[model samples]
Target chain A: MQTGFLKSSPKIILRFTDYNSPFLGPSPTVPTATTASPSSSLQQPQTWICFSCSYSNFASTPKCELCGVKRPDALTSSSSTSLSQTQISPTPILGEHSPTASLGEVTSSPTLQPVVTSEGISCPRCTFSNHPSMVWCELCGMELGTFKIDGMELSDDGNVEKTERAQHVKLAFRNGGSASFNNKLKSAMTDREWEKITEPISVNPQTDFDPVRGGISGIMKNVAQNQEEQKETLDQAFKDLDALMAKASDMVKLAQSIKMKLNKDSSESEVSADDDSTFSTYLLELGMSNPVTKKDSGSIYHQELARQLAEFLSALLHKHKGMMVLTDVYCLFNRARGVALISPDDLYKACSLFERLDLPMRLHQLASGLLVVQAADHNDDVIAKRVLEYIRQKGSLTAIELAAIENASIALVSEQLQMTVSKGLICIDETVEGVRFYENIIINYQWDQQALQ
Target chain B: MSAFDFPSIYNFPPFFTQQPNEATWQTQAQLWISIILSYCRFYKIHRLDLSDALTTELFYNKSINRRLKLETLQSIIKMMIKQGLAEWDPPNKKTSAFIYWKKPEEWATSISNWVSENGLNNSIVTLYEIAHGEASEGTEFHEIDQAVLLKALDVLVKKGEAQTLQATNAEEMGVKFFGTG
Candidate 1:
């Protein structure tokens, strides 16, 4: 499309197919559509204006007889090389129209008739209006219809009802200024919008509601609330989906890891495909949607927080070393509870309550006063033996280096080393590089000598 | 000549630092005390100057990349004094210490045996002759400190096994061991 060079001439039908687009820009032109929608000018045929002579020609004629300008070929794809030079975007221009529709001769098949278009597609070069069938402008030889990227220009006539309900959700959220107003707004907007969108929840909630009565807490309460809020946000997305999809990408990582893990152990679980549908839905529910909070837990806040903390940590311990730094625990616990954030003091109190209970995991404070959570069955002596072996090999190394060896945190490793020092398994070395630990060969050798004697 | 023996624990890095824990500190102190005594005995170091040994390889362990901090070194020396393995010279000033790797009685036994073995019993010998004479060659007391030699002679004299010569000059005093004490 040397559209710039053809500026002086009448617009040419570089690709005659632009006029045959079923729907171009904002208009849907199918004559057989359910309604006699007059939205598209292409649906009706009319006179074709001569682009060069400024002479009006009959719709039946493909060219200007007086100017001897031959009719341009019906629209076809533009040569891709010069697409950017064409003033009208190429993909939106050609749309779905076919070349046969621009042929002047009548076809025997009922569906082959040229789509009668009154609304002339403006020439990219000459500013002249051309009939849908004209492959090239009568005046300029610039290509008429080159743009045709499918799916980008689909008509949304079918989704009108769905989109309207999504709008009502937006209105309600905007009107919610106060907390009570917001709550009411949430309930009011719940029906129709989300109900229509998520006819796909398909799977029932798998968690047993009764067996776990650490009391339902606020997690369940947030679920009903989430349905309303989630739909409202999605309704806002109906207005623009591109941004929403970008934001949703982060939510894909956890699902991918879970999917990878499931694929690795697929035979071990034998879970049905239906279970997987809810699994993705559960991923969307992440700690964000179902957090336990003071508003819901009330009198049993600390107690419930403690139990939830224990349950979460116990599961984590299976993956991590049997311990987590107190600071890390605070962050993860709060994240698992979502909007229900707890204060550090509150976390400490919640942890203290564990001492009074018979839980398997307890908060441990090291000799240096560094705090961590460790399982009751977890043994430091085992780590000590490993530390002893490690020190003997490296001769001596720092806690940070040992952390790398054991795949644990520096804080945890440092505390473990201190305990080993107390046990006389290894001894600490304070050097310029930092503190390192070495095998307590003195004690062992002394004992060995005594045994020999 | 006997080989100088060093305990294997000297190569350990932490062996240089005094432990922070009470029980560990006590054990490390005892280890250091033994190491110091053995090292002195091997080198035949009669007196240890705290100022000089502070920067020596005897205190700073390069293999372990650690050094005995001044505080830890002083503490170990004090523990040595408490155990009678060492005593501070000019007791109040405490600038240097006399390491008693061998007790006075033990030295007296060796000196008495050396005199009898060399047939020098009942024959008076000047202090210098006893300290540096050919008869003293290959003996542990060959190069014994004068103060330590005098102490050993005092032990023999106290037992009535040797007589101290009444010399006009104190420096020329000699001793006669009756027989192998």
Candidate 2:
């Protein structure tokens, strides 16, 4: 089958070139004569029946000469059979006449001849029917065979020579992936396998009945079909996204219900110590169903954020021993909110509103200028007393040792020890081993007997 | 003396560190002053070299691996000068100072008592004899720093109880004590 198509392909090219010679400007006739005689030996009938309108066309005609429908087997069959005996006798005379006679036959069936040529390799970029021998489109200059022409324009003057101006069409792929598409197109062109894919579509009778075969109406039908397909795909994607959103909400609700059950169980008895309750509580912490957004709390954004932060941190502050670094709070709060993460400046501004809003959690700045979120009840005196007691017990304590003992940040411990020093409860010893704090024993020494004597 | 007994506070690591607080540091300065006076008195040390003192056990505690900084020692010496317990030896340079374990007036009272007890009132005594002569053996003034002896004699002269006679040589420089009337 492939060999027959290859053998007939040159004759098909000769016929098209001879038919197009008027616009292409008169080519040599010797090669045409040589190619046409052998094609005549293929013994095609003088006339053939059109499947669409059932009109009998001469073997030299590529389309239905009566109704302008393309012949289905034009690629493989070098020719088609005649319905009447009168048409059959003229086949031998036409074959002897060859190029001039076939050209005359093509001119006779001239209505849709230029628009839909059977053997012409169409420029996929501009839908211009190019002579099969050209590697690039004469009108568009795009590499031939990069795309298969989906439809053709049916006009009296579909001739490329009639248009004097050079028409340029720029294809811009706005959504990216153009490089990959070009690579695939290049590979398809290189393999020359697109012909096989387009051959079946051209022969399929179902596609022949499609209105997109030719004319302005065909283009409108093609566009409408494409839009319908796009709408279907978009609707499917939105439906999947909606289903996923619903599942997420369901999961949140399930977590809330489990948390509620755990709370109730713990209130009634002390049996809520299992891993399931702990896991649920963890999930509950992660789910901040309603975060205070700037959009939702306009004008008083910082105040509202402060309130929300206080509520979020009250429980967390207890777990962290009533103090957490401002940066840590920002991370935890943003993670819990899951979306609409706040900037550090916004978090800082919101924390600044804690005192104005009288929130249970306050913003505290250490001597080192590090900001922390501290509980309202967290007092310097308490920390100082704790440090003093620890220092008294340990004889002397470095900031690092106290930080480890209290499981608090070194900055906080250092600040606490400094406060104790100011209060004269403890004194600092700065040395090569770093600063250490000791009980202020110098304050209680007897001045008279110890040195004045 | 019997290996000058260091106070219990000397063993404290923080005691070697200069205190940062004002009131605490004043107390710490006093403690340092007292320790210095007794340490100097026990060792009969009259002059303190700032740098040399830092390496000694007085300023550096080896077991605690801590040492008083030079600035801290200098400040402490300045406090001692303010208290009249010390004076810069050359009267201007700060690197070394004369530690006055006993004020010059107290030293003068000890010298006058020694003269009255030995029947040497109205008698002329060479400054060198008061510091290193056999007659001054087993006395608090024996082997006294020459500069300190001069200061003590100056106090006596200021009191009109003694007069210093200038001599061609410092060893012959004498102070005549008047009987306490």
TM-score of chain A of each: 0.38, 0.45
Query: Which parts of model 1 are misplaced by more than 4 Å?
Result: A1-289, A392-394, A446-453, B1-3, B21-31, B54-57, B60-66, B119-123, B163-170, B176-181
Per-residue alpha-carbon lDDT of candidate 1 for residues A1-453, written as tens digits (9 for 90 to 100): 223322332322222122223224213322122122222223322344455665555433457766856433331121112112221223322333233442222222343222334686566667677666564565686545422211212223322222222211222445656688757645644432433322222111101111111123334645767898999898887756656534444444555577656555655666675676566445433433334568888988888778877877886775566777888888777655544468998888888888787777888888789888878777788767878888889888889999998777898888888888888887777877778787776664562233221
Judged by lDDT, which candidate is best?
2
Q: What overall lDDT, based on C-alpha atoms, would model 2 receive against the true structure? A: 0.69
Model 1, chain B only, scores a TM-score of 0.86
How well is each residue in B1-181 modelled by candidate 2, as lDDT tens digits?
3576677777777777677677888888889899898888877888899899989988888887888888888899999999999999778888889899999999999999988888888889898888889888888778888888888889999999999999998879988999995
* Chain A accuracy of model 2 expressed as TM-score: 0.45
Tens-digit lDDT string for candidate 2 (A1-453): 322433344333332233334433212222332343333322222344555676766434568888899865532231222111111112233324433444444232333223325577566568788755443466876545211211111111222222222223345899999999779756754575634643443333212222233334455666899999999999998897778655655666776777788777777886646865677659756777667889998999888888888888888888777888888899889877765578999999999999988888789997778888889898778767778889888989988999898887787778777878877788878876688899988866664544423
The stretch of ten residues in a row with the least summed lDDT in candidate 1 chain A is A202-211
TM-score of 1: 0.52
